[model samples]
Target: MPLGVVIRRQPGVTRWAKWVWRAVAVLPGAASADWQELRREGEAVEYHAATLPLTVYRSETEAYRIVLAAESPSVFVVLHPSEEASPDRPYVVHSVTVSAHEAQQALDSGEELVEPVPMPPPLYAWLADFVDRHHADETFMKRKRGPAVEMQSEDGKGDARIRQAADVYRSPASRRKGELH
Candidate 1:
């Protein structure tokens, strides 16, 4: 079945906090090797894969926006149905949240499994645009300083620039005694 995965913003989360949360959300659980494989692609370090088929969406009540069902509370696993299965039909499967250690244990015991969800058209487009907009371009990544210019001093050494200018430019009568006019 086709599953829609969503990560909703949590309450009292600042913009920076949201970014951190998103970063955490993308991290692969203890048992998932898919994330490691995905990281082998171009700039894969920035991409995080969902451990479970779980979709997270924000609730209207502003509580528990990050939701996923895993065997343990800390690890989430993706469940993929058979290719011939219709998405419209509901399938019987257990969805529960479990801990990271427990998830690792399951994987170690040879019970870890995953089903890759095909990227939806809209999501694929969105991800493409997002990467294009956010990824730093190589050309701009290199730092370059602009050329520096030398400034000319108005006065020579030991010359009072202000007084000299005033004396050179001011009328004789306007000049004060012992002072540069």
Candidate 2:
């Protein structure tokens, strides 16, 4: 399956803080993955996977506002904080929704699917740069030139050398040159 990855930044929010909040919210038997942290513009960014395959960010304001958007879609949402806290926190301040059809249309038209909202420009730029920086470097990969060699000794044979005549020139051996000593 083709996964759409969205990069988001919650100003003044730390990844650990969000993790703590998520741990408190998600009950047992809920399918979830640990949040992954990324650094952009010297600030830590946290991302968690959702059932809708969406990325969420909590606003910095104490109002508990949030921004939700499809990372790969042109759609996004900024929702405001809600009075009651239910299974899901309703602190969405604004939201942007981009339809899959719209995203496909943009791709067909050779346009960028990601559209920036009223977020920090530097953050977006940093994300773009970070993605570029992390792309695998395929240039260093090359085909293998040769196979490894296996070394072994013959069944019962071993390395041996003949003794030189001058080295074995003892009196008794010299007298019986061609004879066995």
Candidate 3:
């Protein structure tokens, strides 16, 4: 499905960051948009940054299931600082994904910003249908424990081979100091 990324730019509160760029929403099955200005209110402005393909894989239905199970199901928008970044628009839309793990991976990079935009109704329905068709619960197989070892009761007798003259409960470090081997 074609996904359109909508980025919002607003004046930053801190001096360190002059402008804040964040992904506010996504347009599903939207036509190709290239930095198209959508709305403006005072200093805040929203842009249709890019239109990218949102692919749903059969293998990743489980990840999608986890995404849908959330209280507020959302699509994660990945944004990265552009090379030609300016005071007005510094970040660019990188990608959009439903997989929480993938979003986490993007976040772990420490370079890209990940924003979770609420899943639109049509997109949610599409994802639900896809998951219903492809998703299958994986059966958990519990492994049995191996045969237990018969533990010997040799309390206070440190190493049966070594004979202690002074302290019976001498620490292993103290014993190592005296012994050459």
* Best model per TM-score: 3
Candidate 2: C-alpha lDDT? 0.33
Two-way lDDT contest, 1 vs 3, winner: 3
Pairs in steric clash, model 3:
none
lDDT of 1: 0.32
TM-score of each: 0.20, 0.21, 0.77
C-alpha lDDT of all candidate models, in order: 0.32, 0.33, 0.87
Per-residue error (Å), model 1, residue 18: 44
Per-residue lDDT over 1-181 for candidate 1, one digit per residue giving the tens place of the 0 to 100 score: 1222222222334664322212223232234322233232232232323334433222211111111222211323433333555432112122322223333444565533422223334434443344445444345567789787645433333445554535454445555557733
**Clash count for each candidate, listed in order shown:** 14, 18, 0
lDDT of 2 by residue, 1-181 (tens): 1122223444435764541221111111224333333333444343432212333222211111112133321233323334674323423322222233333444465423334333334433433344344434345667787876645423323234545443342444234447554
Q: Compared with the true structure, what per-residue lDDT tens digits does model 3 show for residues 1-181? A: 9999999989899999778788999999999988899999999999999998898899999899999999999999998888896765677778899998898899998999999999999999999999999988889999999887655434346666766564566555455445543
Cα shift from native, residue 6, model 3 (Å) = 0.6
